[model samples]
Target: MAVDDFKAYIRKIIHVDMDAFYASVEQLDDPNLRYLPIAVGGSSKRGVVAAASYEARKYGVKSAMSGRLAAKLCPDLVFVKPRFERYQEISKRIRDIFFEYTALVEPLSLDEAYLDVTVNRKKAPSATLLAKEIRQKIREKTGLNASAGISINKFLAKIASDINKPNGQKTIAPDEVLGFLETLDVRKFYGVGKVTKDKMYQLGIFTGADLKSKSLDELQQHFGKSGAFYYQVVRGIHLSEVKTERQRKSVGAERTFNDNISSEIYMISRLEAIAEELEKRLKKHGLAGKTITLKIKYSDFSVQTRSKTLGLFIASKELILEESKALLYQERLKNSVRLLGISLHKLNSEQNSSELSAKEAAAASRKHEQLRLPF
Candidate 1:
């Protein structure tokens, strides 16, 4: 095909997401938690839910909601602490699954990713089939179900993927794309969060069709910068690129013990090791974070977490260990500890600095080794 004709041909984009990622991992690892109302996060007064299983969703539990509120809503809700290392490992496997088809893959988190398989290694003509295969591979390898959405662009593909979640697949072909957008709720449009949704409702924009009626200038006048994006989306036009180089916001290390531990001294020692490892990573990246969080899992599958916001970005081993240790001290572990984790958050400036330093260090190390006699 000629370059122009190829560009005109319908593109295939797939959005794949693991169902209830953290909670699902807990369920997969523990037979008792399978098919149960599970939450992956802390279940304390000062805690929040990181992820919740489908069963727990029925009881009004949600991510970022207070754990106490979730327990009140669902008395039987099982809270399992986050095992970030396990999640990272599974994420790597999922990414590997995507690469089997196309190298144009973008990971949004440890549980969700996007792939542009316009020209795949398998030479499969249908994006739908490729998505189905990827989901299947993820399940077979990780023992988890993933939802997929296939469309021509990232916006529609991401929306379609969530339509049929928890081991479901859906596609929006070019011919049906407009009709699909017309019927979609305004809130479902990318970037239309709670505040924007409320503003659109006030203007009688309940559906994509309603939004399509407004001129670009009118939308811009109403929404400023975002209005242009809204104008484009209602008409099925989204130009955001599937980025391959978005720096990881944070890097962490964690572990889930085979047996639950209650000794504070033991837990502190383990946390100290994890923190040291994390600091090494931060230094290697030449990056730092302003927040440190400590995660704990209990024998009963209950979880507890605490975080501390530092006044300055921390990159040294001592600083990370100190913050992690302090956060752990703040949490009250009611049951035997099954897991522990340390994570750094809110990374921005450090990314560039870290990347440069890492490159320079690698170059220097290579030079030193090359100069040394290989006798």
Candidate 2:
């Protein structure tokens, strides 16, 4: 509708998300399970769902939801533990396919990523065509389905990716940007959470149309720095670039157990295993951070996080295990814990991460080999 909307998105971006990634992998590995409602999370009273298959979603199951509730909603729901290693292997193949078209790939997780193909190795004329081809290659290479969204910018691409999911693709042309956004719910706008949506409703902003009607000053009066963001986003203005080399602020792993454990001894052993896994990730990524955070989720779904900042960057298994146990011991358990995680933050510069000592490299290899596979 306006010159501004068309000017900002000269670059083409695409977001690809694997449909029900972990759950889909589980189903692909076991054909008989494909017909059933599959939930790839934990199957315990305290477990949370990691991913829900299309069948599971029919009964209102979703990722990060409690497994107990999922079972309640779908009585015949089947649960399986996550296999991160297998997922990682598949992700590499998917990314390799992306590299064939463009070198600019930014991974959000093992299951989702954003790619900028404005200038590509293939020199494709249309981003939509690129997205379609990428999705096809991913399915062909991995035997897993992926969905893609093609747009001029990241914001639109991310939203469009969810339009027709499960091995589908959508594109938002420049002419239709404003109209497409106007019909979208304010709740669906990026960064507008449930709390923010409620606030928007109270302020009489129900959809993009409502959000667009508000003046920048009125928005600033309500949402602070984010107000300015909403002002630009409602009009399809996003300037963030697709970065090839992305830095992770944290690296950690957590697991949900089949049964809630109240024993301190068991928790210590589990924490050690988690610490070993974290060290392997840190070594693999060539990262070390100064702040170590321990996350605990209780049987009742309540979560707690305790963090400690050190004077030096540390990524060794022994140090992570030591600090995590210290934080764990400090907490007085009011409930049987179900999930535990350790993440590192305040990462050091990446310049020195690649230069691991011979001993350190050997230790990392051993850690990788000794990983306690959940599945």
lDDT to native, each model: 0.78, 0.82
Tens digits of per-residue lDDT, candidate 2, 152-182, equal: 6789899999999978999987667889999
Winning candidate number (TM-score): 2
**Deviation (Å) of 261 in candidate 2:** 6.2
Angstrom error of the Cα, residue 238, model 2: value is 0.3
Task: Give one digit per residue, the lDDT tens place, for model 1 in 193-269.
Answer: 99989998999999988998888898899899999888866666676655554676777888766557898888888
Worst 10 residues of 2 by lDDT: 366-375
